[model samples]
Target: MESGNTITIACAASKRTSLHGLDNIAAEGSEGYDNLINLVEDLHSMNVINSEESKELTNSIISKLKEEFNKDLDDSIIKIENWGAHIVRTINQDSWRLERLGSLLQGQGIIIMDWAMKFLPQRFREKQTD
Candidate 1:
């Protein structure tokens, strides 16, 4: 029937959209992870953080990001009857966690980068003034 065909088409479209959404999230997370790594490495280079501490911080962040990404992907899958209702329910349940994880990464990246920038420059200035 035409209605059945239309329903199938809509479902397919929704699925594609969902996949694209997940891809977007993955890309954003990847960028955040990269920024975190760069910030830590820069701190190490500036002697602001030692090698062991930098290594541990980097590994912990990478692991947490991977875990969160997998969890978010799993959570976003549509498995129930009503597509709209299911999406709403998933968003209500999971969006806060996802947003929090993202904000944590983003916020930390900004904070660390700011501190590293200032700390290194201030140290250089102190040396010159000495």
Candidate 2:
């Protein structure tokens, strides 16, 4: 296994996270992360966890997310998948045109995709810039 560190979810939250360069986090994973895991374990011992578990439960969830990401990363269309690919894929799969989508992002300044858009009432998608 690679050197995996225990990245504390608390330290990663919006309130606690460094606002500077928030766009770029985690360039790559490193080794010698057992120490990090120990640190996270200490956090858990302090009683910090979700309703579903007593401990914060890091490794298993991290592993599962990594597995899902590996599949996406290996995909031919978007190796290092990003927003642009996501836009293209949605259009290709839904038989949507770029112009129609542009109206959502450019005109509205926000693009709500897939399931998240379903909950949005028409009022949420009202008149936009030209």
Candidate 3:
């Protein structure tokens, strides 16, 4: 029926949009991760944090980011259902990870937190309310 075809088309379009969103999040996270690493290296070079401390801090932050966001994103992409509403949910989770990372860096007195904030996606830069 025409209605059935219409529904199918609508669902397909929705899925495409979800996939696009996931791709965007993945790209943004990748870029943010790279920027954070560079900031760590810069801090070390400037004698802000020692070499050992730099390595430790970078590893700790990256490990948590992977454990919290990347793993979930990968798992979700493998499931069909995840291409729908799950994408929307995971996007929020991914953004939250970035915000949480910013807070963590600030708590550690990392002076580059402001520079690091610049790399976060614009949507994330906007304040969110619970």
Best by TM-score: 1
TM-score of 1: 0.41
Model 1 weakest 10-residue run by lDDT: 8-17
Global local distance difference test of model 2: 0.49
Model 3 spans with C-alpha error above 4 angstroms = 1-22, 81-130
Candidate 1 C-alpha lDDT tens digits along 67-128:
98678667765433367886797687567656656777443632223444467768677642
TM-score per candidate, in order?
0.41, 0.22, 0.40
Distance (Å) between predicted and true CA of 20, model 3?
A: 8.6
> Lowest lDDT 10-mer window, candidate 2?
23-32
Number of the predicted model whose lDDT against the real structure is largest: 1
lDDT of 3 by residue, 18-122 (tens): 544456455555556666888999999999999999999899878976795767667767775657776887688678767866788444743333333454545
Residue 39 lDDT (model 2)? 59
Off by over 4 Å in 2: 1-40, 47-56, 76-130
Candidate 2 — which pairs collide?
A: 3-31, 4-33
Ranking by lDDT: 1, 3, 2
TM-score of structure candidate 2: 0.22
